[model samples]
Target: MKITEGYMPYLNYQTYYRIVGDITKPALVLLHGGPGSTHNYFELLDSLASDDYCIVMYDQLGCGNSYVEGHPELWTPETWVNELIALRKHLNLTKVHLLGQSWGGMLALDYILHYSPTGIESLILSSTLSSASLWASEQHRMIRFMSEVDQRAIEIAERTGNYESEDYIIANTHFMHAHCAGVYEIGKAPDCLTRPKKTGKEAYLYGWGPNEYTPTGSLAGFEVTD
Candidate 1:
């Protein structure tokens, strides 16, 4: 399998992208989550690359190799949607299959609905939501199953807007282990999850608020459901 990588110019920023397998084959584009998460985590799917279709992954505007700062305003879904369009145009990806996870799933839905771009062969959404309110409600429901100590930590953190407290951090870690990524301990997770030297924390904060259970940012009431 051949691997190629480069930066695609999008507006004033350059999006770093990687392609595995033959570029001439149909494209299977992978979209990550966090609205700020990097594509590194999707490296696990690179094995899907073959002669049928190439695997395409890229870090969005403000994370990983495409890291940019001092632009919280650009953390909106529209910003990322336009960047996706730019990537497809830059790569001349006429036919594609999209696989989006979590926030990435939300982005994929937004793109398909807004532009209805042609040549979308298939779409696969994993662990995503169409309504922000529903997402928050579900998170709260999940939190209810946690220990009272963890619950108190989260409640206090939410009330004080102090997600940096030790208790809050511990509680959040517990939640992540139970729901997000619990297969391995802190440092034992795959390299893709830990290798990024920088992350789009600002973007995450601006777009998603303080933590997973809270919805205070631009996505506060975001809904695309009918």
Candidate 2:
């Protein structure tokens, strides 16, 4: 039940991470979604901490509690892949299981396909879409399910390229809470919202757009399915 927090320097940035449970046990690394999301969403996985597994969670560069400086162009998939490798080596973990949700899964696959890390023992992809095209399709479907007024407003907003409109943001947030988390709860716990910030908000907006479903950022053209 021991928890430790630390930082690992990688390339031009540093990753903030937490290790929970017995270090002597099998290691399980959890990767959170959002090229910008913090590890706070996976707090539930801490329950898995025990003698059987050592859970490791981290905020990637430009997100959560990780180092947020240096180069913005370095936020590509390849950089993230190398960051994970660096963290593994820093922790001295020989072999371990990987669990990634959404973008995390994408990064995990990128690592597996490219670097072929020697210590990976298993992988778990949860609530993750394999490709940006598939995610876009799903998002369209979700938009269609929205109220007629909301749908029209969103359509017009996108058509006019007015993504910054208050109406568009409000409608988008509504759809996100309803269809994304599948949890309608309004307020997050004080501690939940009070967690340390990771990366610059601009990094996420520049990389993944305003939300997961809306792919209007640098990753808009990103897709992987074979």
Candidate 3:
């Protein structure tokens, strides 16, 4: 199918967006994860192009083609939600189906709760954490299944805030492989799992803290599920 791409201007920054399939069909707007994650990994959405769904994907202001980096203070969920509104208006999206993943889901929830905007057909939240506390608890629960070495590495990393260490990375990778989508017992990290994702450190550090188990960023507080 035909793919259309453009930069939508928002608050002195340009959000890079791409559309697959016909605009006449039901529009499905996909919001990516991370205060830092790019939209590249959502390639699976392309199939929806032929299924009568207008698949839209975009990298938020601080990532991918937009690359409006170095402004961590400005990376608030409100700012991102505003950008989403801008993009919707720019594209003249009257009726939309919003699908957000992880932090993207958090942003979507924030927008609905704050603005209560209409015209959304549905909201699909994938692998989202309702709150930082919930995320931490889940990570801790998952760690119990790991080996002693991996568990030690993860524990030490969390204790010392040394997520950058090689041991921490290895341990984190193993944990991610198991819980980040793996189905087998262990040692079955898929190619997609092994691949490195494009993430902005400034956005992550300012928005999500030093690591996954910790919550010391702008979004440190707030309860979504509770």
Q: In terms of TM-score, which candidate is strongest?
A: 1
Instruction: Estimate candidate 1's alpha-carbon lDDT, on a 0 to 1 scale.
Output: 0.89
| Shift in Å, residue 166, candidate 2 | 1.8
- Model 2 local distance difference test score: 0.78
Estimate every model's Cα lDDT from 0 to 1: 0.89, 0.78, 0.81
lDDT (tens digit, per residue) of candidate 2 on 104-190: 898888788767688789999987766777788788888998988788878878788777787887888788788775553445654
Deviation from truth (RMSD, Å), model 1: 1.8
Model 3: per-residue Cα lDDT over 48-153, one tens digit each: 7775678989988787777766787777777788989988889888789999998889888888778888789999999886778878887888788899998999
Q: What are the models' TM-scores?
A: 0.93, 0.87, 0.85
True-vs-predicted CA distance for residue 204, candidate 1, Å: 0.9
* Per-residue lDDT over 1-226 for candidate 1, one digit per residue giving the tens place of the 0 to 100 score: 7889999988798899999988788999999898778998888887889878999999988888899889888888889899999999899999999999998998899899988899999999999889999889999999999999999999999989899999999999999989987665768777876774568888888888888879787878779999
Top-lDDT candidate index? 1
Backbone clashes per model, in order? 0, 3, 0
Cα RMSD of predicted structure 3: 3.7
**Which window of ten consecutive residues has the lowest lDDT sum in model 1?**
189-198
Better of 2 and 3 by TM-score: 2
Q: What number of backbone clashes does candidate 3 have, counting pairs of residues 3 or more apart or in separate chains?
A: 0
lDDT of 1 at 135: 88
